[model samples]
Target: MPFFRWARIWVLSLSGLVLTGSIAAAAVPQDMQDFNHYTFAVMWHPGVCATWSNAGPACKDLSPAAKINQEWTMHGLWASRPRSLLAAGMNGPTWWHYGCYWYNPEHALPKGSCANPPLNLPEALHQRLYAHMPMAQICLDRHEYYKHVVCFGETPEQFFPKELDLLDKLNASAFTAFIRDHRGQWVARNAIMKAFADSFQVKNADALELRCENPSHHIHELERQGNILTQAWITIHKDKVDAFPAPESLEKGRKGNCAEKIHILN
Candidate 1:
């Protein structure tokens, strides 16, 4: 939720971190759809860049441009539905994969196929963006715009700033504060979720999902132990960005790979 910048680190070789997996196949609609709720994802840049930098053009090679730090960077914003509004009913896939024809039958396009102009945010706005979202590679932004934001019918200009606003709000909260203060330490899941609620003034912990990954593969010698926090998913209603929604009671199996005792990697 919070963000920061640190001294640069030069790497003679990327051999220190070797990622062994492929990027998950995107499960998004190829066409546009209407939705009433949203899922905002904030990624920990160091975690992502550590394993994924060389995976593709979308991933930034942070070895030369970034230094180690405790910050959660913007990933992407997704529009989705509450379980009660799902067409497939509650028994359907709760994973909310976009670009899936079943989800957006009328206009679904293939993932990464949408045609969009450059995300020409104003100069002042770009400065603000660079400050908080420095690690998101241009290719990654383009893919997100096509795969997710395109379905919302808002241009990159309109959609990305909205996402950034949400990230800014969380970055200013106590949830991120807890992460920053406890980097490299193991933390209880309940405590972390509680901090999210307290910081954002939300009432239900279920509205927040903690995402963790293997630090041994995604980070430097942070002394790998249990899973580490890599991302956080929070639900917000389309009509009420000011008010956090109650828990959607979405299936637990659909949640990101996080642990009960999460390690906050630096």
Candidate 2:
């Protein structure tokens, strides 16, 4: 790690800094070593609420000071399988061994480290998680910690804040700004990819992928037309935080379900 980044983490530990709306912390656990890459999944809150609200509790109203608009909300941070293994179909057991204890293909529940509390975090830490992840009935933070973060081997203290920080980074990026500003408009898939490339200074469209949902289907109980942006998945290397691979280099499942053009719901 760079000196400044290392120093920031050290200072945070010594000070036990409080979590806030603007920034969150991330940790690299001693035992849970780095892997092939990481996936930072971000959700469009408006799309989620439109389709999933009735499936769970309504999202909490945001405080006036919260930086998140109804624009983007966090989904989860995931450790991705290496491209080599992915090519060999290392999705089920192999993927779980990396830290996300997924249930076997035939099962509905996962079996692994996340079965219990991953850390002994204080109440304040929990509050910070709740603040950043406000969608209801899901116990979003707890579920994420168990399913994803637990396998990461970081304590709750080290994990939650870091994930929140990643979310903040996304929310502050030009990519998110472009999507939010273009709401209520139909955007071409290429335009979306180009915007991400421009915003992040990534020249390759293969660096990122967008997931869209067809809300017109009654099976999902949403009323939106055509496809709607739901999640943005970005790939990063395990050791380096910002290293991105071309989209073709990503796992096969990264591509989302969308047509040539999709509507950006407000």
Candidate 3:
């Protein structure tokens, strides 16, 4: 089985994009928003697997015993820019791309990163986490842990559970249900954003950034024969993260890459 790799994504620069007209999000109070935000990224398994032709055995396991597509799985709880990395001139996009491997390619393994030191999560967290996060098959857990979580100001115990808790909230929300109910169907991007805002009872849906494997870009997407919804990245204020699913807790996220209408793979 080939290692599951994340094709470089969300590589577009966010600068100079004017928040024009009615879609503009209210200016976040300067004291409230800046770099103190974290992106809680979740993957739709079927779309994820279908995104790449060389996806690993985890996606090939066709067993009913491990139906990983039953729900969204962790991508990572990515910090925008921790102070140390920022001072070192690691801007948001650069930090988002390279993650821990920005410093050294050898810091990451081409195969499974399972050999990286294990996370020190508590037993309870480990068990709850074991329930999903299917990419653990490719040691993606270790990849994400080392790359995104290490400097995130929370221990593995603190980070994973908090992310899991938020995932629960999203799964329970109308947002998740909207996508889940529409699996195998094409849905308008605007509608998806609207459902997300309605689910959280928020004024702005821009807090949710949508990502997809586009047929326009990848041949694997052509194989899927459509645009496939893959991930949703939500911006949560660091201080208000514990209060997520609340309107004020989520800040606006920049636009992401995806077609105007994308399919949610069944």
Candidate 4:
């Protein structure tokens, strides 16, 4: 471990702040320890709304002309640990879970925007964020900013526009169209992965981790609706995040808890 990171750890303990340190090194695979990757996540808006309790804030009051309502929504652009935090000995998974809190233990990660300081973003970028990520309506933009963007070592001005631009490019891809085509219908997981592979022209789809919601356990009324595609977690090489989906920027990710067949809800 680097000297500065160790010093930070010692100072944090002296301050008596509770720190959820990185997971056990022995328990995690060697590759997972380095955790140097970016997860470019986007959610399927309608499917996200379908499984939640009364449709969460992201889905509420969504306009007929809302872009998020009709397309896959931006979830976040997360780097496991950029070089800025790496020298302080912060590991990837810890950064993924705790973010800025890992580096600045005093700044609590807020459940809502009310407790956090507002982001320093332009009005236009704010509007773009809201359009691409409806959860921004509830100020998740602030949450994402503090938790992840700080690691970028750049102002909200430099960061958000770049990320949203990537989302625009992704939206124009065949992968986006495939999800739209399957809305309110069933899609095979392999077929979806193949479409993603084709869209990015990657060697395979292992770079994308699929997340789905099976609301049956919680909402018994929707018991028969096995699974709804909710989020796509595409692993990007940390060094190549901005050049995303370039074959060199890809990495294998953990494919999540979806069944072989997924239903994309609209």
Question: Which model scores highest in TM-score?
Answer: 4
Q: Which ten residues in a row have the lowest lDDT in candidate 3?
A: 1-10
For lDDT, the strongest prediction is 4
Whole-structure CA lDDT of model 4: 0.68
Candidate 2 lDDT, 1-266, residue by residue in tens: 23223323422220122211112224433323435666777777656654553434434543323344445677777776534335545565656543333321222243322333333458897666665666523555655665565434455677767767766776777878898788767788889888877776666556576887756344322224437777777776566553333333333235666667766666
lDDT per residue for candidate 3 within 92-187, as digits (tens), equals 777766664443323332244655555645677776776667776666776777566543234566567788888888777888889878877878
Each prediction's TM-score versus the true structure:
0.65, 0.67, 0.74, 0.77
User: Which runs in model 4 stand beyond 4 Å of their true positions?
Assistant: 1-35, 61-66, 82-93, 111-113, 216-226
Tens digit per residue, CA lDDT, model 1, 139-201: 456546655554334655566677777776777677777888886677888888788667655
The positional error of residue 78 in candidate 1, measured at the CA in angstroms, is 0.3
- Model 2, position 46, has a per-residue lDDT of 57
lDDT agreement with native, every candidate: 0.53, 0.56, 0.66, 0.68
Task: Report the number of clashing residue pairs per model.
Answer: 14, 5, 0, 0
Q: What is the lDDT of candidate 2?
A: 0.56
User: Residue 97: error of model 3 in Å?
Assistant: 3.3
**Model 3: clashing residue pairs?**
none
lDDT of 4 by residue, 7-32 (tens): 24432331342222222334322332
Flag the better candidate by TM-score, 1 or 2. 2
The regions of model 2 sitting more than 4 angstroms off are: 1-34, 53-55, 60-69, 82-89, 92-99, 102-121, 216-226, 242-253
